[model samples]
Target: MLLSAAARRRTPCPGGALLVVGDSPRVVVVGGGPGGYEAALVASQLGASVTVVERDGVGGSAVLTDVVPSKTLIATAEVMTLVDGSVELGVRFPGGAGAPTDPGLDRPGGAVTVDLGRVNERVRQLAAAQSGDVRERLRGEGVRVLSGTGRLAAPDRVVVDPADASADGPADGPADGSAGEELAADVVLVATGSYPRTLPDAEPDGERILTWKQLYRLQELPERLVVVGSGVTGAEFASAYDALGSDVVLVSSRDRVLPGEDVDAAEVIEDVFRRRGMTVLSRSRAQEVKRVGDGVVVALADGRTVEGSHCLLAVGSIPSTAGIGLEEAGVQLSESGHVEVDRVSRTSVRGVYAAGDCTGVLPLASVAAMQGRTAMRHALGDAVQPLKLRTVAANVFTAPEIATVGWSQAQIESGEAQGEVVKLPLVGNARAKMQGIHDGFVKLFCRTGSGTVIGGVVVAPRASELIFPVALAVEHRLTVDQVAQAYSVYPSLSGSLTEAARRLHKAPSVAG
Candidate 1:
């Protein structure tokens, strides 16, 4: 049966090409995060009128609160770590004529103190600038930007409530009207994103107890910091603060930190954390957190307590799907409250789609953007390939970062995948030797029959950047031999990746 133009817009396109529609469809995207904004852009490019309703600033948590702020803080910590290692490279900070000289680089008498106030100011400034940039870019793309809270009034309509006195007023509709405006959209994309999950007993006061968002408010550095939950966020902060000279403790309910990551990578990070004076409390869970006098205490489930100047809860995140009229609008949500989305980012309801952390998909910013683009392409009568998770690359941004792409070692061990594993230690790489880095490796997985690169893990400084080639290889189905034959800079960290692929190509195949 031939479908109407409107019906065709709601239908998913099979091929990866834009479907030229007779009429421009109206697209409404809620939330200004990477997922929301990217979807808006794609919809606009596909000849649809797009409006983005953003409650917070543009760029969402990944840019304004979570990813950008944390990574900036880590950059400062990395500088300190590099300075501490300068003595090994024959670099010397000479003492004053009458001052006593330090014997080792690690024990430099010149004490370095972090100016938390300055660091936080810079972080906020950077976040704000980036948010502004995103907003400007959206405007440049002819996407109508609405600064308000948007909720589904119906499958084809969105009601936007004006933001409070804090924001720059409503971006559309009457400025003085009490009743908000309602927009009729042919397609609605929900990308409201997620918020940091906190326990009822461990509420963040923003002073003593902090969420990742509130950490920037501190004027003074924490003398002792305790991080709850050993996930990516917790591990990153713990590692950064420790490097910044804080006495840090990381509490984990799992047997090890980053339990969901590559096992070898997680083990190496835990070892590095402990070796650098961090207290790793494995198999420990925080039952409650309370302010005691001038300090904070985290009571464990086993009747033990850990005290620190401040406590940070990194337990996890909850999708921001509540009170948004999603369920009432016939959008299916998972048991955990995340929007249930298919490969092409469609919701259960026609013309309604979801993306980002709100969909319970991979919580990375890159994944969020891809899902958003996919949702737009599918909803705006454009052809789109379904999202493929096998090629997604994720990184833990701790010092000497851990990055992994595609199939994991656990998959092979569980007989879920058939592959051969090959590893190359960074210590053997000339660049690593020159940089005095000894504790990292690159591991690659290849198919048994065709030597196709399936997955890989990289552990080293800037592993995030080093994993890109491997990610591309997996996404394009490039074979191990092809990767090995690719040219790489001599004496560079990437050589280790090529070397691992070369070894995988030469290794004998094992049956699944």
Candidate 2:
């Protein structure tokens, strides 16, 4: 059993002679993603000799392929979107700004064009720089970094194989006389992360058909792009490509795009998507994608077909936990192959823990980092608190970004929570009005009894930045009145959050 924080401080380090007052435990972390590296750093700070084994470069997919690269692409798309509305804001350029009055050399060849090659090169450079930063930070903190695939040999030992070797090979074998190095550890953390899920019938050819990661490699944008799946990834890419001047068709297997997100936010975004001339095919499940003559065709479940210059599959992700010797060391995994971990990141096996997408927790990088810290604190016998995901802030990086934190409306409607909800449209916000932004809103949920702010959803330009205070309120359990009392700059989108909280606090409480 884990000791309480107070008890842990009083307890002496096991098998220690007080060399420097406490024992420095050895910690070995597998997969140098946000979760693994963050835990290594924290464990090192707590007097642990740490080692991180990574097959891929440091920062994992979050920096190298998924999060950072996608966001960079989104940033470019966002600029284009803003430029599209510049005319409405009274901004003028050569050729009379806004839409071109004439298509043929309108006002001496004045038009905006997205250079896919330059944008992709910049995205790759940024991702590489961030990965290098993570690598440098880890090494500077006295953590040993190994470029290899790591697997458990025993409860207290990890065997690392060369990156080129098959990870499924014998764990303890010195068969080829180059079986790789082994490291003994007092504790181990698994943060192998995940990979994009691809369908057998719809394989990405890295050209006309691509995954989210491969989209950045194109030299020229697709003339007409067909995006499969309308989840967060699909919606983001569809919105981005449309903004970047591509004829985008979004195929959803559900009733609407972003079906899993807040209904109102999804509706608003869908409206925006249609208004921007995107072809949204609801209840359309893509069965397969096949290459045609210089294009691709996406066959739907209902025997319909959509052809485009390119096809992108954004179904979901699968955890990278297979053939890593996890179960061999007695670690439990969910039926879906994700590590089964508790709130403190502990697995069923003693002295072993997991974090990030591999653990099937919230798939956000921020949540992964928090889980890593929690794992290290618990492992190093320091004061630690289990993670409460209710306060985690998540954002969908579409045109008008959607950000949400804390208790959702589903929780309230299901009778699991009782809260008063107040929604303030972004149209009412002075900054949004001035910017010619007419879509999106700020919705806040407050506990009915105590008026404590529970959750919130923000849908506006850069909603990711505006959702921070609501996250703070949820994390600190601040009351609606307390949140409302805070000062916000005039003519700002964030002021809407304060306004929503004020309204919630003023409303009568509803009993559960």
Candidate 3:
């Protein structure tokens, strides 16, 4: 709801009391994840007194467990992949086993190895430092940082429980709860993130059976890791572990891996997975997973069985909304338990906004941050733009990464989007050839008549970095001629994007 300056409600300033005129808005942000903290910063910048309440940590699961830790571990695995290819790159370990890392260069069964303990230690430290940085930054911005679970007492009132001994967030209060503090708010933001989706039959033991969150606790890599679910999360871990010398078997309920991603890109990744010795079990579903003695066993719905030293569950995530006072406060929740928020991030209840996974929007940190800023802008009566999922770029960090933006090929095929598609294999790129990379492609989608860039996909070693230009074109509605006119570095993978655009210089009569 946009309001004029004269009609906007008075909010809290630096002073204690919240009810008054000609002051900042009292913004209480619940959950200190990307959505919460980013909203807090925006609220502060918009002349609002902000407070962040979190029980996990300032960075929430995105930092503490899920995104940061998994990506950091993947980084180590990526380094291992690079080192394993050192010999092909004209570099070799001198005298074989003389190097440090306890026979790192020459493992009995592998060419390169990673120390899971040391790698996880680094992951933990980096995540903690990142969380600390957020706390310090928020405090510097004069935003009150409360380490506790926040509950909505009313639409305009938030009560914070002083963190107990079990919480792992920054300490802004005593460990033991002596009492609770309540704050009046002109606007409230709920950014409580989601947790790993689990099933009754497939429980994580944090040892042999584990969720993605429990992967970093391992001191030794799984000799045979069976990963259930072939979605983005499963594919990523399967690719990472395969690169890091694990015998990986990926189980997919769908006929192909990455069923949600680009079909061509999924094919490339699946082929690469097979070529790299990782088993791909398509059209297979695991009914239950259980620990049997030292190893874990996964029973298939088809009466088949898969045994592995460890199992990683990467099915999906559930919103962390239960028993959080949202329903009690009259904030309407979806059947899936996600908060129902409009594009502007406003919940059903006025003065209450939701962002991040809780809102059931695109589950990306970048999307969360954007939703957060947009929510604050709307709440504070500032000029704002609603969240645009079309302009958002998404990347799957596999060996040959897959990055995509805007309208997809499937959308175009289904007539949901009108566009012309041009696909150029990265195997033909000069840089890919020079780097000994043989897989991946660059596919571009543009409006048929005007040649306005609509969408694109990149599959390469670092496709994440390469998708930005395409995303920029799609977001700003740049023409193919404009993108082609722009110079990409010669002998580069990015050149393929422009090359694909150059091929689409004129609207095609049909798909080519």
Instruction: Please provide, for model 1 over 1-512, each residue's C-alpha lDDT reduced to its tens digit, 9 standing for 90 to 100.
Output: 32345564443345332333555677889888999999999988888888888776678778888888889999998887776666666665665122223321253334556898998888888888888788888889988887778889888789988764422111222222232778888789999999889988998988889898889878888999999999999999998998888899999999999999999999999988887779999999899999998899999999999999999999999999999899999999999999998999888888888999999989989999999999888766566789999999999988789999999989998899999898888889999888878688999999988999999999998899999999999999999999999999998999998888777766566999
Measured against the true structure, the TM-scores of the candidates, in listed sequence, are 0.91, 0.90, 0.91
Clashing pairs in 1: none
Q: Per-residue CA lDDT of candidate 3, range 1-512, in tens?
A: 32344665565422122333666678999998999999999989978889888887788888888788778888887777666545444555745333334222232235445777898889888888888888888888988877688889888788887654533222333222223778777889999998888767999988999888888778888999999999999999999998888899999999999999999999999998887778999999989999999999999999999999999999999998887689889999999999999888989887889999988889999989899998888888777787889999999999889999999999999999889999999778888877757788999999978899999999988899999999999999999999999999998999998899899997447965
Candidates ranked by TM-score: 1, 3, 2
lDDT of 2 by residue, 1-512 (tens): 32233332233332221112244677899988899889989988988888988876678778778898899999999988887777666566776545444221122223677999999889888887888888888888988888788899986788988775322111111211133788877789999999889888998888898888788788898999999999999999999998888999999999999988999999999988997789999999999999998999999999999999999999999999998899999999899999998888989887888999998889999989999998988877777788998989999999899999999988888889998888888878889888878889999998988999899999998999999999999999999899889999997888898888777766656999
Q: How many clashes in each candidate?
A: 0, 0, 0
Quality of model 2 by C-alpha lDDT: 0.84
Tell me the lDDT of candidate 1.
0.84
Q: What TM value does model 3 have? A: 0.91
Residue-pair clashes, model 3: 0
Q: What is candidate 1's TM-score against the reference?
A: 0.91
